[model samples]
Target chain A: MSPLSLTHRDTVAGPVLLVAGELDFVHAAELRRQVEGLVLHAGQCLVLDLSGVEFCDSTGITALLAARQHALAAEAEIVLAAVPAHLERILTIVGLVQVFTLRATAEDT
Target chain B: MGCARRVPADLNASPGPTTGPGLRSAPGAGDAGAPVGETWRHAPYPVLVADRRGVLTGLNEAARQYLPRAARGDRLRDLAPSWLAEAHHRLAEARSPGGGDVPAGHLGDRFFEAHPTPAGDGRVVWWLIDRTDALQAETALHSARTRSEMLSGIASTLLSTLNVPRCMEVTASLAAQHLAEGAVLIAPPQGRRHQLTYAARGTGAVQVTQQVDTRSVPGLAEALQGFPPVPARWLNPDDIPDWLIPEGFTGPVGSVIVTPLPGHGVPAGALVLLRSGTEKAFTEGEEAFARLFAARAGAALSAARLYAEQSAITATLMRELLPPKLGSVHGVEYAGNYRAATDQERIGGDFYDVHPGSDPSRETLVVLGDVAGKGLDAAVLTGKIRNTLQALLPLADDHQRVLSLLNGALLSSHQTRFATLVLASVRRGDEGVHLRLTSGGHLPPLIIRADGTVEEAPTHGTLVGALPQVRARTIETVLAPGEICLLYTDGITEARGGPLGEELFGEERLRRALAGCAGMPAEAVVEHVQMLAFQWLRSGGHDDMAVVAIGAARSGGPPTVAGAKDGMNL
Candidate 1:
């Protein structure tokens, strides 16, 4: 798996986490740690841009869920942006599609 | 060898035959008043000649620069340094025999060798050769050689063993003997207390565990942490507390050198050298040498610690992660095997167990699962799930209800990880082996019929833990005599290896492989699948693979599906 890289860029709405590379077991925890450090407001929505993700495993999905948990704990909303087809299939299969707010692209919402 | 042969010759040549050992021979009228040659007058060293009355006769340019106050015909006692003057007086008074030893003395921070030659008529000429720089160099060279030897000794001794306590003992004793009169080695704090090893010069090391206050000593806590791990400090002797001083160590403290024993990753420990009041103070060079010793000790100690930790992990995983041995239960043949992604890894996310029922009529519950993630974290979760599932054995009759309870248990836990598992209730019937299989987001079992046809058990469900509930639909199937049904993890189908080592051993390949082993025994079938998967993996990157098989015995049984019971003709 390719090593994961993360970039946090703040937009007018909120911080958009630009996650890249393979989000497998090796790097899933890193994403959670990065999300935990974010400063989110009550009304602002946090976007996880997964456009550059080469792969995602079950642990990667858990990390995404943990990111959601972190955002909700801060009274903020989290959205998965530009979700890949494979990741989209897993999110639906695990019933996370109902739990998370999903968008076609980062600029959609 | 050459020096040994030449020493005696040199000694014989030193004593003059005409001049006795006396300070001067009786005055000879035939000898010149001052018969010294021109070479002696312009010598690089200081030289002087005097009569028995102790008057100067001749001196060289360097001697003129060295003894500016002494003029021609001056008495040697008043001008020359006292050590030289005293030697001259002793030689005169003792008379008649000499040629014993050259007198060495200091001259204004410089050392000199005074060689006295007897001249005619009770006169003596003395030569002074400045040997200050040569002596200093010899001393420095000796110490440097000694320190290097000690460093190599420390390396060989400390690195030979992997035992932590033994390494500490050796380090303490070596420092005490070489660096100072006593030494104390303090290992990094474990929990709260630290393990201390103390040794005094000429004594064996002693080990003691004490709750040491690290902040009491300056630079000690930092050294233990290896923040800037290489500095060696010679702290104030008074600053060394009673706790730091070893038991039975007497005399007032004079010098203390503290050095950090840096390790591969973490700091191994710290070394403290103590010298008594009478002992010489530690030089700057000695302090640096102590740091080098500390490095060797640290590397050995840290290697031992890493080995210990690795073995502990290996043992723990071997016991916790290995699947239970499967065999015939209630006349149904059962077998299961597991392989981790890599040989070095003894444990992973895959886990399975076979629990026998109270009676043959009661189906034995079998479990196989793949926990989310990998490595220690996932294995830990797998263990918790297994324990929880064991606690819910009474509810094994209903797979859907068991899945719901497990999902609830996992959801309440702190970890965000999840798992997918397959549960099969196995029972032997008059017709064949009956199985009620349920899949909770795991792949369903593929049944190998008597006709060598592979069929998937009609079971589908969502993964456990992520959702609030598990909505698995349990499906019933009967394995005819000599028929086998297999439950496996995705690790097999997802493994990538081929001629190019980039192909997946997918579901279709798995079905074809199982179809070939349609009538084989449970053990053979599991091994066959494992063999094919390994061949596909072929040193390629893979995940944890596991397979469990349940087969109906063909002995005295009828073939109920697709035939004439000729499936096992081979």
Candidate 2:
């Protein structure tokens, strides 16, 4: 029952939002707001660091959609980093894992 | 209220001010005769005229049918039945001379809009238009708006729930608030009896906290005892026993809509919307809204279920990749722990495995590795490495040779692009226990002694598939009795802690944990180490960890591949 939390650190690649905690309906809007505030430049990459995330529900998925929209609106790209096993499975089942570029961490190619 | 106006037959009738002896017919009917006079009576409404003496002067065919009495010569005071005469008098006093058309009274479930226009002198023409359709349309529109608002509120409520049951309750209550009364009953039958649960509206005096068994209501049981549930609207009021109407449901009411809540396939339960007052009956529009909301509620339920199912599946899949329990060899006992990350969505590719090697009579092959990514990509890579390792065991007893084979397979195959791996095999039987190990950019295994000391097994090998000419080296060691050994993923070594990044649990913490638990049984040793790992991370051990613990079950026991079998995998 650790409070679900997410943190974003701006890297050379647009921004890297490291999310930890339950990304379910309760906190999804907060995550979306943070994503919305990101300044996406053309050709930049918005990396969603999910290494610390424990749970992600449909609302969380929608937040990711919002983040993707923010990036695409600016003609930028978005990627996922350190996606947890459970979240990855869900993303895969829903065919989202394929849509987003995934890396092990910031270091992984 | 005024003198009656006799509209001449030849004059063009006014568009709106419908008048004459033809205006007092039935409410919905319009005149169908006499060109000029017909137009006046056919002005899309019923017009009635009454003079100052309250004498009924004109009865248009259209206006004649709507009233109980349309006799031309009768006085208005006597023509209408007693009840209606009093109502008309009240209406006349309330009518404004220039108020235009407005609603007057409700009669027999119908609403009336009365428009009174003064004629020459003191006569008045009362134009009555049936407004039930317009009022009903307006009410329906309001109901739809209310339903949408309730749905939006439910969506907001769903956002805060993590526990599935609480989410379901919220969804059910949201649906209930828009249906039936301010309370709703959800009943799912189990075996011979149905378990009924109720949720009340956001604000109401009625507390919907009751369980009604099938036996308690004979009608409900009979309705349920069919292929498809008997619709509540079709149930005769006489057929329903008095006790079944719940607490507030009294006497005969409007139609009760019994819509069965569809399950995955079959009908799971019923949504009964009982209409009480005549005005409270469910319209088709309301029923459609209920169905739409029900579909959304079902989707939410399905989502919760999918989450749980995937969680269980992920745990199972992670377990499947781990080695089974191993028997004691010499004096060594073996055990291991595998955690597949905290993500509830996908199964990770981190895996550990143990099996027989080329020298079947003497050794057991043990492999541990973490796929570069997660989910299916990582899982597929793990699978490839695992299958290759298993296939190579019978072909090579040398650790470097086995590692070389894995590298070649990874480089040649399109399945697993690349991976980090550790392959180790231990000799069993009288020759003591000889450990042969190789690493492919994988975390090195740790050897713990009986004297409370720890060392990283000195073996560094090229990462598998990184290059075509990647050559790996093998390190050999002989383990004595009453000793412990640990092999794991970098998830353990990379854990961060302490103030200002001062405490790196790294190898030191792991060494201490192993040494402390060295004297315990193998499984207990694994658990103790795992507990330390969890504690060190302070956060459910970020990133999945695969731990293999090999120790002596009793004193003076040698560690062997048989022991490594249980320790190396999972």
Candidate 3:
């Protein structure tokens, strides 16, 4: 299954990619490709809704890093929504959590 | 003659005749010469002369009268029966200065006693007396001795055995010995029928044993079917149907006595004795003994059954209440350990649940909690709380709302019980990840980053079921890639670390550990944090713990906050 699932909802958060499966070695490239396909632009914020992901291995982690780099290159920002407790711990320990802007829900965006 | 007088001179020399020679009548000198007619009439201590060879040489008038012989000499040995002659010879040999009574001969209804006196001639004076009364007394004395000995032998045989069948066998043998011609049969009750348990005979006959139902042995049934059952006896031959009587049972079976074994419950069987026509029926005392035996047997059987049943129940209950292994969740391996208290009847109070997240897209939802007490009651409450959470998870919007709903669901019953719970939902995003944490008076979640660093996630709510007015704690954190999170029960933190209960690897210690583990993946992060928890406690944690970890990729840039510049990230 594709790690990156694109879903659009007419909510205040705008177009969202609800990543519903694990972004691991099995599907990280697919996730990276989906992020690269997004129409990035300056001033626009890409919302990555992660409520569906059950796991995020190192490979998935790298794909996520690539998504951020892509968005940065386009001068556009990225928002990580519905971050799970396990992933938050990894970020905090690595001091990378301070770099991510996380919210409880996409609506919070 | 005087009672103690010495008789004539000749009499002392020759006492009794060898063949009763002296027992002859006196012969008066017949007139002058013509052959005197032998006067053989009176024999009073008859005087006759016999030689040592038992030849009679002469006879006086009394001798002639006692023997009626005209000849002057006769051989006495040929004149009497051998037994009589032998008696006389024995008397002669026994003779001494003081004479002893001698057996002369046996007569109808009489025994003779003879005394002898020697005379000048080769003769002896023999006096005989009858001893009928003494003999009769002796016979009677011998009969009584035999009966006493038989009774003692019977008693010993009865007491020597412990086996029921052996005892029964001995009983039958004793009966045959004393009663003479009858066989002994013991029919024990077998369900609705009476089965012949034992039968024996000294006659070397194979005893026929027939099975008799209660219907066939009605008289026996009636007597035994009573409280403190008694052995019943049937004496009428007609009472037993001919077909039911064991084969080879012949003669007038004058009577059959069926004695029920006396016992607490129905007798195992009755002891039925078949008396032959030639033998007398069983007396009342024998029936009483059979009943006593049955009573003792019944007690043994009941005791054995009771012991078996009690132990079986105890073992069954233990197996049912204790679990062998914990449930495993995919992507979230779970380990549960439980120990029962020393209290025999108490059940465990720890519980846990792993369910699919309410949002199909979210990470696994895991909850582990414990009731406040230890017992069946606590266990029941634990089950209730676990079941309620499982039921609500699929529909509940967030981890916090699930706890609130559970608290509400238990408000009434919670009047007496309290529980600690931790609920966690894991999700991954492109930049990092998402987690919604809630605590219900439970231990905070342990978050382990890929760098081997650890932190206890803060819970912002009160213990579930603690109060009617309580809100759940909700915290949101986005995990950068390569970090892990753990949610556990207080069994890990409050675990005593030192003698004074002073050493505790509290939240800070756990945070440091998780920080060290931040370099590993989610699975390894969980394992390392648990290892530290165990090491801090110096053993397995003291109570139940549930750990849930979520990790994400690394990004040098800050995780994008949704509408970061627009809305406050509540």
Give the best candidate by lDDT: 1
Tell me model 1's lDDT, rounded to 2 decimals: 0.79
Residue-by-residue lDDT tens digits, candidate 2, B71-119 = 7667766664443344345545654353322335553456555545545
Q: Which candidate number maximizes TM-score?
A: 1
Model 3 C-alpha lDDT per residue in residues B332-447, reported as the tens digit of each score: 23333444332354345655655643232446565666665556666677778877877886754577677778888887775525676677665545555666777665656666
What interface RMSD do all candidates show, one decimal each? 2.8, 14.6, 18.4
Q: How much does candidate 3 score in TM-score?
A: 0.37
Q: Going through the candidates in order, what is chain B's TM-score?
A: 0.59, 0.56, 0.42
Order the candidates by lDDT, highest first.
1, 2, 3
Between candidates 2 and 3, the one scoring higher on DockQ is 2
**How does residue B343 of candidate 1 score in lDDT?**
79
lDDT of model 1 at position A20: 94
TM-score of chain A of 2: 0.92
Q: Write the per-residue lDDT of candidate 1 for residues A43-98, one digit (tens) a residue.
A: 88899999899766677877987888888878898999998886776575455666
CAPRI tier for the interface of model 2: incorrect
Q: What lDDT score is found at residue B399 in candidate 2?
A: 73
Cα displacement (angstroms), candidate 1, residue B104, comes to 13
Which order, best to worst by TM-score? 1, 2, 3
